[model samples]
Target: MTTRDPAARLLRLLSLLQSRTDWPGPELAGRLGVSTRTIRSDIERLRNLGYPVAATPGTAGGHRLGSGARLPPLLLDDEEAVAVAIGLRTAAAQAVGGIEETSLRALTKLEQVLPARLRPRVAALAASTVPLPGNGPAVDGDVLTALAVACRDRRRVRFDYHDHKGNATLRDVEPHRLVSTGQRWYLVAWDIDRNDWRMFRIDRLRPRTPMGPSFPGRSLPPGEAIDFVTKGVASTLEPCRTVATVHAPVTAVSERVPPVARVEHLDDQRCLLHIGAAAPLTLAVYLAALGLPFTVDGPPALLEALRRMSQHCAGAVSPATPAMSASQPRADAW
Candidate 1:
């Protein structure tokens, strides 16, 4: 047998233990090409650092991973490695709202350890992905940091929140969580002003420089704070709202309608939908696509606008209709 670096040999043994389900002493000795005596010493070396490798005495059983004093390094298969690589790429793109720089830093660390062959695979995948930002507002880095700190410390924040009509009012709210939907970042908190949970767009925030003192967090909100924030922010725009009586159940409408629209139950098999849009025609068209009967109550202007739009569209033909054949010259006429 060849004599190899004992330390390197031991580390190799540990990697095999972590990777395999079970190994008998003979099998392990055969793989390492070392005597069983050497395997015991190597096992001891792993145990010293908190790995708990258990040896079973039966022919059916061999050596397997037992709970360790502390967790050991993960030995990922090819698929898991690729999944992790893709996740890192996503985070680095900053689709996560406030964690862009931090995600990039973590990504650099991940790239450093990648096996040489896998590194190129990750790079090729990353090259193909691109991000397209939408019309949603972006938050200030400082506000993100400040809110994060407040959430971590269990603090209350007091600030002047500007309403949709651009009315500024003083508020004191218990900071809860920050949520990020693709187009926006939101801070969901118990609005001290309204005494209700409200989701504020991060871009809209002008937090009072020193956030108020720390307080115990409320029972963490029902689901993710982001979802609630998305809902709350959406509900705020109801001034030029459309109140509709739709044939569909509230549940059905809620499921079909986008988060941008609002609906409430009028009764079973029926729902009241309230939606607001900057463009009345656009909103009207979306509701019309539901293919159900609906009655509307709204500003006369919007109702008239929808009426005109309906007339314009009712006479319209499907876009898929092919255009008339291009004109052709006749040789006989020439």
Candidate 2:
């Protein structure tokens, strides 16, 4: 039999090791078309490179890759490779701090090496999808990772946080889960000082790691993590509220409005929309585009903006003269 290159043999051995929980020595040798001795040598080579390949003692024992302090290169199957590449492409479009550029760079590298058959699949999916850019603040990738690690390891973490008012304060918390809402990332944690659960914006967090001691995990709040974060965000809205009664059913209008807005049914045919925006004019424009006739019940500013917009729209449609001579061309004439 022709001798295989040591590098190629080692990579094959590593791939086999990564694909399953364990492989007996003879089975690995048979699969690699090598002797048991070569399998041992290749396993040693992997360990020397910092991949913790562990061997068991009995006849049924084989080798398995064990966890290490640092992440090793992933060996993904075809489906896994496509999934990861697609995920990286999606992450590149989000506002996750410094990682946006990093994700794109990694995706480029991965796509360059994808098998010929898989490359076009990934490219096709990417070409068909369009991701709207998020308007939320960017978060630090390292801080995001640290918090995630703390959550998984059940360790408490300390960080300096700034509130909506930009008031800086120190926080010590037991990290639980990290939630992403496309526009923003949030961390739901148990605040040690306050003795309550709090949802924090990832952008507003500055985690100081060499994290605190581990704590016993507890059940999350009554709702899902996303729900907790949503409620937390809703509580911080500005005072500029816009309430409008729309001539549409609650279900129909609710589907058109953003999840942050409130839709209360006035009856079977009408619903009240409670929305908040920094600018009354912005709210007015959004309401106008809802395609349903609505009456503004407001803080006066939204009403004024809507009224002004209405006048402009009315003037735009009304002709300069009520009567036109037959010789004059009609407005709707081609």
Candidate 3:
């Protein structure tokens, strides 16, 4: 004779119930490797959790989960549910290219099912979310779903990608993961065409059909998928990369910067930056606007350009004495 722990046995019963539509008392006992008596007790625990489990007796009898009149006990606590609702609502605003509509639909359903006590908190959080402007083009939500599926199912994806310079190329990749980096999303995968790993910003992709075939997956390299994409997108992939010596501590400007931009501290008052932007002039203007003094490091042209712009913004760039500063506080003051 064997005796199984009650709670563990109860969880096993729930797992059995979730796996199929119906199971006879004997069948459940056999699967759990427990006795018929234990199976009956496990059913009690599930019922306590609000699962609408029903049983019929005799040879035709079995255990089945029925539709309940109310929501079952969920795994998440109040704070967790509120966070999920807020995140989904935020996603709906992103209406990312392919999935906005679906996100809105899912969010609507989740919000509808919220319990009376949690409703206000979820509602308030959803109402207060404000989405900022996004870069990267509109990405189709369907693409996200498809990529996600491929990752989960260990399948392959084929798509046409448009590069930074607007060059189109066909690709076949084994999608290992999806990475959302602020305004944009990316996929990290093993590229079939190049025979190497690569990262793609989802908006820049146009998936090709008949999709692609699943392949044997390999372990992903160190680092999170999103960080890998962040480094790729914010680094040298753009038209140009610029490094500037900003005369400010890294901490002072870290929060005000984008993830694509990198900063290294220079003593207590200066930091070096590695940043990418579409145009050299645009890059120069951005650094000049940082409100901190900086020395342009390279691409001699950019240095000369920054100097010229500095002269253009001479009055704007200079600090006025505290008295003169306020009549017109320096736009660069902050």
Candidate 4:
């Protein structure tokens, strides 16, 4: 059986090749419902159109799509086209520094070719959504690319890193993984000199030339890379830290706090929360906002801050109303 419309058949053939790494001539013919001879002609037609479709010889030979000097038009289904459009729009607004403009350019080109049916859906989404401009420092595109390549190939990289106090030091590490938390990028790696795992902010490091030899991959620290980076970043950035006993279960407390805060279960009904902020007042406000029953021990400053907050709340109430009930343990209960 052969397709009556040659153009439609060629599109189906292209889609099939793009979907997988290899396809035997007979298999391609069977799937397309065409003769092997017709498959050969279709393959030639695709090649003539600048698609780098590579063919192999011999009984076990097959065809595969290989990288070419230029990119050809891609075949995307309705859902795929919309997804790409939305992704590009998001990247344009919040991606690492240099790619924003490039993303917009690509989006414009895609919109031009998008089927008329999808235009309004994409437009409505773009119009209704707004991305907050990221205030975090921008990462250099070249440095990002170099680190990505090193991680992919399991190679060692040396870089100059600046700590929070502005002290500069040289670092040599085995690349492990890159983690992004919407606002910043972090590299989780094994520090050769420290003999331990370390997380480095991508924006704060400058990659040195001549990458070191390939390395054997090491197991990442206990949890997911994102969690490791989050905990490390919070500890490094905030000077004041404390642990509190939250009356709610771990699952309940986890939902209210940022991922940077660590939550551990103590029992079925109680959990521990490890959190930090620049000052005791800030921490007080954060706990108060939780609206959960919790208790904090000394870090005398935090206790005093909570006492002050309690007074403030008491003072705000009217004398006519009964004294604020204190039977329950709350953030300001002290």
| Candidate number of the best TM-score | 4
| Model 3 lDDT per residue over 184-260, tens place | 77889999879888998788898876656668869775365656686688764556677788877888766556677
Residue 269's lDDT in candidate 3: 85
What's the lDDT for all of these models? 0.74, 0.83, 0.76, 0.88
Q: Mark the 10 consecutive residues where model 3 has the least summed lDDT.
A: 325-334
Clash counts per candidate, in order, are 0, 0, 7, 0
In candidate 1, what are the lDDT values of residues 188-231, reduced to their tens digit? 88887687877777776688867787777687664656556545
What value does the lDDT take at residue 166 in candidate 4?
A: 91
lDDT string for model 2 (50-166, tens) is 989999979979889899777777767889999998899888888876777889899988888889989888989999989877798888887888888898999999999999889
Compute the lDDT for candidate 2. 0.83
In model 4, where do residues sit more than 4 Å from their true spots? 56-61, 221-223, 249-252, 265-270, 317-334
Superposed by TM-score, candidate 4 places the C-alpha of residue 139 at a distance from the truth, in angstroms, of 0.6
Per-residue lDDT over 251-275 for candidate 4, one digit per residue giving the tens place of the 0 to 100 score: 8888888657889899999999999
Q: Kindly report which residue stretches of model 2 are placed more than 4 angstroms away from their true locations once superposed.
A: 1-9, 24-42, 48-50, 67-73, 221-223, 238-334
- After the best TM-score superposition of candidate 4, give how far the Cα of residue 31 lies from its true spot, in angstroms: 2.9
TM-score for all models, in order of appearance? 0.57, 0.68, 0.65, 0.86
Deviation (Å) of 213 in candidate 4:
1.4
